[model samples]
Target chain A: MSNQMFHTSKSFDQDLTETTDLFLEMGALAGQQVAQAMHALIEGDMHLAHQVVEQDSAVNQLEVLIDERILLLVAKRQPAARDLRYVMAVSKGVVDIERIGDEAAKIAHMAQQVAADNSGTYSYHEVQHLSNQVRLMLHSALAAFEHLQVERAFDVMRSDGNVDFEYQSAMRALMTYVMEDPRQVSHVINLMWILRALERIGDHARNIAELVIYISSGTDVRHSDFETVQQAIDASKIG
Target chain B: MSNQMFHTSKSFDQDLTETTDLFLEMGALAGQQVAQAMHALIEGDMHLAHQVVEQDSAVNQLEVLIDERILLLVAKRQPAARDLRYVMAVSKGVVDIERIGDEAAKIAHMAQQVAADNSGTYSYHEVQHLSNQVRLMLHSALAAFEHLQVERAFDVMRSDGNVDFEYQSAMRALMTYVMEDPRQVSHVINLMWILRALERIGDHARNIAELVIYISSGTDVRHSDFETVQQAIDASKIG
Candidate 1:
């Protein structure tokens, strides 16, 4: 290749790497926000809860920044085929990460309310366990994306089922609480919203995992059953 | 411009138009699904509820198709500046629309559960009102997007507050049922989930409205307070 062509291609690669790095930075920040929100919820730390809410703007800013970078990258490079897929995957992944941050902020807002209402005291054990599982799924999902590890992505997908199971158990436990003392209904509902947010966080993480598989294998596993996703990934491997 | 250049530009515009038409089709379908889901929930129509669940695949298919078209458009046309923003806006809008479809299916699933347990009957009056508001917001949001009407987008954004208020009132009403008779906790929770889905649908619609504003004015109003968004749009108008 000519020197000018070589230099242009090299810079395009650099631009892609830099954009991916920024995207991952956003993912990591979102994960931290979720963790802090969970901590605030369990410990009833109003200060930390407030912090999580405030820090959500940082994630939102990153989303805006990364979005611009992707648009510029596409405009300048006009990458095709796999390169285009990778850019599109990152674009979608940024949305999921930003949503994860939104969910974290939501959990923090509920934590503040829960803290203020001392009468709403209920068991945090289930909530804590479920949050832990969700955080891990998110963490691993990002890791898989960073490294293009399809196997790890599949693991995250499988673990989403466990999150769902845990969510159901927690819901049942809260229902039992409401049954035992109907007055706790208001408080239990708040906890239910928090659980619901965590469940959604898991779903977003699973979406990222699906994007990872799509980026690596060029297969659209979204809207597919687990068996179908697994089989598609396996077939991609053999091919 | 040379005839060749003019012909290429015209074809690019045609491609853009075709892609946008498909996106609007998806949005229309999603709105219908949400409306149908509400009807199913209110009337306890098992067949309609089942049909909503099955029809979700169609929405999902449209999402996959739209994604591919957007990717190809970007790759081939290499849209820049305002053109790039429009493409990206449509791309993100598709995600929000698909989520609306998912939420509708979720409502349908809960409707099935409510239909199975006839004794769980509670007042659907508040739920119906909330669903109607959410559906209107979604429909207006899409219309705003299709027409690129910033004023209409602002209207949709402003209405989201009403949806939130309605959601809270519904929550309190459900809490009353649980408190009056704790045995109704399970049934109340089912209704709560449906309400929650409707509220989320409202959120997704608001997101599309944000995209509409972004596409038209080149100003992203996401993550902004309503007052700020209004001010920004007004300033854009004056400038």
Candidate 2:
């Protein structure tokens, strides 16, 4: 009877490992969708924009699937301690990813609007730069999650401040341009909305990085000072 | 031996009940603080705004306390099925409440700015009305949570649209006021930000209500059609 119980427990642990692997797969797909959306925006590819919108539904579906699976695992297995936190983190991480998908969809929608306007007056270079920065941050954040790299996750968090700073500058620049040339206000406003959406994407990526840190370190570093979070991570590694 | 086992299980259940009750108490306090912050904004009471800001730390403390307690329970009890759902919901609920507190602090900060200017140029009546609506919605949402009243929660979700509409109108009115007299633009802009913050409060309240429904019905109602959510709630109640 003891031998049978051990075998069953081992299988259950294997099942959980598989589930975690699936979650990582879903995360990678969601990240790809976000990056593609950014590319569509920068390249002015309406087809790609539409594709991103369509792909968002799949991301949303995956969020629901992952949530249900986590719920079932918690219900059936009664996960304790670290395993409990891992499941909970997966649930919240999926939410962050879904929101990222929504932000990507918003970007795609804005891209469509910009395409329709046929203004050709506003330069896309600044917007492209901001998009690339956010995409890199998101990519790094997801990679950090897969590898359980606390330092990489912290890097993602610090990168968020740069995204916000750039977004603020873009806002000011766009506002000044609109103030000077009222005719271009509509186009500039559309671009501003896109920039805001990208900045929100960065925020969600930061949230995912924080969740990664929490799951790996078993500490709630949310709203903590940056240096404090770094110290907590280091302590967790040592302990 | 069976009697001793029964006693142990009963004590464990009682502890969980007590912990859940504590979470509910904390949630209630957070909701009240949110309402008071809105009141401060409408009344232009800098003192009350300061009080709200100070009280926010207490809310943050409660969030941490609740989180730690929940983690301890999961580690100790190995609760299953519905019990797991309840604990997970409480954890998520506390986070939402903390965010609600943050939004209240935001509104209070904006109120301080408005009070400092001492400009009677812009009346707070419209924002006051919107704040009242959102406050009531938040109160009802929390009450629905306490009672698990799916119908009332759905009502809260429906009211979100009204709050959004009011906020948009408020924004247009503020923009028109600023356009008419550029001198009061700064004050009006501050008020606009306050209104946006309140609208976000409403959004978060709706999110909490949706979460409550999810916990009670085991259904993911997010992104579902309004009629579908209502139908699901009705089904849950009937069954």
Candidate 3:
């Protein structure tokens, strides 16, 4: 009887591993959608913007699928201890990814709006810089998840501050443009909204990175001082 | 040795239960603060607003306490299946509560701004009405949590639509007030910001309710149709 129980448990573990891999694939797809949205905005490619919007539905579907799978696993497999933590982390991580997809769609919508203006009134350069920063953060954070690399996750979290700063700078520049020529305020405000959405994408990436650190180290790094997270990351590298 | 292990597990479960009770108490306190913030806004009472802001530190401290306890429980107890789900839900619930506290403080700050105006030009009626609606939602949502009443949670989610409608109406009224009298646009805009914050609070409450359903039923009620959550709630009651 004991040997039979052991075999059953081993099979359960294997099934969970397979489920986790599927979740990671979904995360990769969501990350690619975000990057593509940014690229579309930078290139003023309306077709690519539409593609990002279209892809969001798939990401949303994946979120629901992963959520259902996690719930079923908990009910059936009764994962304990470390496996429990891993499942819960993936559940929350997918939420962050789904929100990132929403933010990307929001950016794409902004791109469409800019395209409709037909006035060539708004420049995409500032938005391009903001998108690049956010995309890099998303990529690094997802990579951290793939490797469970605590230090890389920490780097992603720290990068969020820079993205936010760039967003603020972009906002100020846009404000100045609006103030100088009030006629352009409407178009520029739309661009500002896109920049804000990109900034929010970075925030969601930071959330995922925080989750990664928590899942790997069993620590609640949120609300901790930056220095503490950094120190924890360094310690994790050695320990 | 088997007996000793059983005793240890029982003791750990008792500790976890106690920790969860404390978390619930903190949640109730946070809800009260949110209600008082709305009251302060409606009454134009800066003293009460300041009190709410000062008390926010307590809410923040409780959030950290809850996080620490959750981490400790997961590490020590290695709770399986349903117990693990409950722990994860509690952690996420505390986060929603913390955000609600932040929103209350934001409302208090807005109240302070309105009080500072001294213009005596802006009528507080619409703001009062909007605050009342938000307070009703907050109160109902907390009651649902306290009772574990799924129907009450569903009610809270549905109430969000009303709150949002009132908020948009308030916005429209404020915009008209500003356009009709350009001199007051700045003050009206500030008031609009406060209204938006209150609407966001309602959104957070809905989030908590969705989480409650998920915790109880292992269902991902989010992104699903309203009827689905309602049906889940009904099924849980029957079971």
Candidate 4:
């Protein structure tokens, strides 16, 4: 945000800083959960998966807190355009982070489901590959958000297509696996659910990236075409 | 909202009403799109399916409008507790409705894919059943949200379990069909995607129902046990 956009109220500035800190902390926690949830699944550690599930409540609480703070801040300060955009992006970004937490819990739940019965173990190389890609995407996206870097957000957005491609390929390969061996249907289905959750996390990261770009450039890059976003990225002013 | 909650300015009430009116219209339009998307798939009418995808932008625009009005109202009037909760619920409610529209578009996109290669005609009875169930859920959920009917929202929540059961059954059946004839893998996959989309729509409707209860009771019923929600529904102040 620009210096001119900052209000004179000391409390307002402090509250904004506190909220941004909370949001970043929440995002980092959620990213850790995503990684740990995948680890629990790959290791077949039900205890760790349950821990991930239990930790989701904390993420939920943070979302509620962040949203309440945002509404309060907007009502009290009535900041200028840049600050308003920042507030809006953070408010919207919290939801995606919360959703990512939910997705992590979903991955954990799927892990528990697969372990419920002594069934065949589904392969995880592709899932791990996709998870790593999204985890990195999320990490970079969060950094971009922190620094208000629109170009970094564009890079995150570009990486998402590869995640999509990986997801579809994994889904098709899983479908083929089940078709080849009828008995593997249940096992493969559980794995597919995990893949779907990971794919959704990637989408949420992309959403946060778009919001980051919006806050930085005052542009709605969400539903715009690739060429439009690319041109905006090319012509963007700040780092 | 209570009389005390209303601002002295007449435009406050007018803007609130306008926002609510826009939300209800968007919900109704999305419900219609979901119905039409299912119809397109069952009848192999790619035209209607494509129409659903193309028309999603309008629903999206309504969300943007509702959100903007909400922020403006909060910044201008700073509504009291009761009105604040109502505004927050409505703001969050629009996200679920917009997501429902995206799911409808997803169903339409899947329909277009299945139609691209007419290898087989997927069964429609279960698909229609789940589609009808979720459409009704969205309809009733939206009504409950409009009227703040906690009991009706509870009823909507109860129906979602049946949708989940049916989705699982349909997935199992689809898997068996693909196993029986590998040539039908692509066709079965498309049907599975449609089922998944419908299932997700049901989930979104359930989320909206929970929000309705929250707005009415000022209680966070989300993620609460069904028994707890049921008790709250029984003891709720309003219908």
Candidate 5:
């Protein structure tokens, strides 16, 4: 994250910097895919949804490229201590970004399915709200990662609680719709799947934020902050 | 997996062997948690379900320990070529194993919720079958990993299709049940969550099998096998 974290070799530093930049670019693309999928879902635009699906290949390709770069960087340079941790975290964290891309593509596929069905009875307001929360979560997490902002990373982690709350609300609302009209069961289930993917995207974003924290502080902060935030999230949900 | 895959470095070999053993133990425990969660759902065994939930901590701890070991081994030994690939695969593969643990814990939580409801009218035969398929899939994948059997790994990847099919069938059946009587919507939804976790467990297993093939043959087998297998899985769902 910071410029001076490792100083053993200049090439290793450049490789690390380039790899992180590629990961950020991939993260940004994934965020766009999630947004575009939601746009297509909301506006009933199958064309954009198809584009989102097609774009996922680029994200996957980036992951493979990042992996190859990491393998070369680690094998050739042999980073020690903090430098090694940074490479390891980036290699692992990029997978989360790739999976976030998968989730986005899944949302787009559901959009395509709904578009094919040609049903205009549903508005998908809940999905739109939750996915916006998810996008913000991922965006902030990526910012924390790019800048190595520990405070921002914690903020992103705290924001994940709100995103999860939105996800559960969306699921509950979809369940209510299905219960109201059994004929809409299929429609509601499709939206439910989209919501599930969006919720998971938020979770993955939180994982990335945790990675930033791990890299910055050299301490794993997984369950530490989340539980307190989760308790608050749950209490807010109940109240 | 072969004897001569990596050059003879006794301590690196020992570290690799020990790290892999930890991963296998984590995988097996995740498999058991999944199975026990289903058993608790079927038999209404709240005690076993609670145990499954509690046991997830051990799995998490194993992942952390394995990660620490991996970081140390990679930094100290600086393994090259095949050895480096093996370490990378194991490091990434272990995360899948950890996620499998999360899915199992999720299933157990759903079991706990259903058990507290104390309703005996619902039989989870479909879920039982699907979770069993998932367990076997993961079990085979881990065995393939431990023995470095490329053929067996391929078989595990192929078997993921059946698990996906079973997952769709279970979802369809649950949808029908909920549509038939909306009063049982909550019950059906709970079972649906369990099935979703089982489906993801299968997906994770397939990812691990991919890792096994990657380590064994020195080639990434993801897009190669999954595209072909996914089509069959999708076709089976329709027909």
Candidate 6:
């Protein structure tokens, strides 16, 4: 290859790295927000909850900036094949990260409501456990993306069933509370929304994991069962 | 332009048109699924609900096909400026349409559950009205995308406020039912999930409308207030 071609390719690689770095930065911030929001909710820290809400703008800004970089990279580099798929996955992954931030903010809002409405100590242990599980999933998914490790992505996918199960268990427990004291219905509903937000965050993490698989395997694993996705990943590895 | 350049440009335009048409087709199917699911729920037609559940795969297939076309279009044509934005919007819009199908399928599942548990008329009039409003919003959002009309997009944005209002009202009314008869708690919760799905469907439609605005004005109106988005649309028109 010519020197000039080599130089162009190196610069393109640098651009891709920089773009991925920005995406990881966004993911880290989103993960932090979810953690902080859950901490605030569990501890009834209104100030921390407000902070999470305010910090969401940073996540949104990162998303917009990352999207701009992606558009420029595509328009200039016009990356082909694997490079193209990688860029597309990065673009979609940024979206899911942004949504995670949104869900965190939503959780923060509900936390504030729960704090305001309930004077007594809120004793929803399941929400805390579920939030922890979801945060782990989010962290692992981001780690998978940063390292391009399909194993970590698969780990995240496998954990989602546990999150769903915990969510159902939490819902059932909350229902009993609501049924026992209808007056606590509003407060319980707020907790339910918090649980729902956490579950959705888990889903966004799964989506990121799927994107990781897509980038590595050139497979659209969306709407596919776990077995199918696993087979696709294994085949890609062997090939 | 030279003849060869003109020929290439014309073919690119045809590709863009075909991609957009496929996207619109998916959007229409999603809209129908939502409507049919609602109809099945209110009328308690298990067969129709199952049909909606089954048809969702078609929407997923369209989404995958559209994504393939978009990646090819971007890699081959290297669309820049307005054309690039249009393609990006179409890509994201297809994801939202597919999600709309998912939400509709979720509602169908809940409807089936509700049918199994209760023989009495499921008097969720608020859900019916909310479904109608959301269907209109979805239809208008698709129309806006097809025609590239910011005004229609704005209309969908404004209607979202109404959908939210209706959703809260539905929730409050359902709460009263649960409070009055704790035996109906399970049924009410199912209805609440249905309401939640419809509200989310409205949100996805709003996201599509935002994409429409983004395509037309090159402004990322996401996470912006109505007044701010309106100003951006107005400025784009003036510019």
Best by lDDT: 1
Each model: TM-score of chain B?
Answer: 0.94, 0.90, 0.86, 0.94, 0.90, 0.95
Total backbone collisions for each predicted model: 0, 0, 0, 0, 0, 0
User: Which candidate should be chosen as best, given DockQ against the real structure?
Assistant: 1
Q: Comparing to the true complex, what docking class would candidate 4 get?
A: acceptable
In order, what DockQ does each candidate have? 0.62, 0.32, 0.20, 0.31, 0.50, 0.53
* lDDT of candidate 4 over B124-168, digit per residue (tens): 788899999999999999888777788899999999999999999
Q: lDDT (0-100) at residue B146 of candidate 5?
A: 86
Q: What TM-scores do the predictions have?
A: 0.93, 0.84, 0.79, 0.87, 0.90, 0.93
lDDT of 2 at A99: 74
Writing each residue's lDDT as its tens digit, candidate 1 over A97-172 gives 9999999999999999888877786888888888999999999998888888889999999999999999999998
All candidates: CA RMSD (Å): 3.9, 5.2, 6.0, 3.5, 6.4, 3.8
Scoring only the A-chain of each prediction against the true A-chain gives TM-scores of: 0.94, 0.91, 0.89, 0.94, 0.90, 0.94
Instruction: Using lDDT as the measure, name the better of candidate 1 and candidate 2.
Output: 1
Per-residue lDDT of model 2, residues A123-194, tens digit only: 877787888888888888877877678899999999999999999898778766765665564577678768
Better structure of 4 and 5 per DockQ: 5
User: lDDT of candidate 6 vs native?
Assistant: 0.87
RMSD of 1: 3.9
Off by over 4 Å in 6: A1-8, A119-122, B1-8, B119-122
TM-score of 5: 0.90
CA error at residue A152 for candidate 3, angstroms: 1.5
Tell me the docking grade of candidate 2.
acceptable
Clashes of 1: 0
Candidate 1 at B13: error in angstroms? 2.6
Candidate 6 clashing pairs, residues 3+ apart or interchain? none
Tell me the spans in candidate 3 whose CA falls farther than 4 Å from its real position.
A1-16, A36-57, A72-84, A109-120, A183-185, B1-19, B29-61, B71-85, B104-129, B169-195
Q: Candidate 5, residues A51-118: lDDT per residue as tens digits?
A: 99999999888887888889889999898876887889888888899899999999999988888866
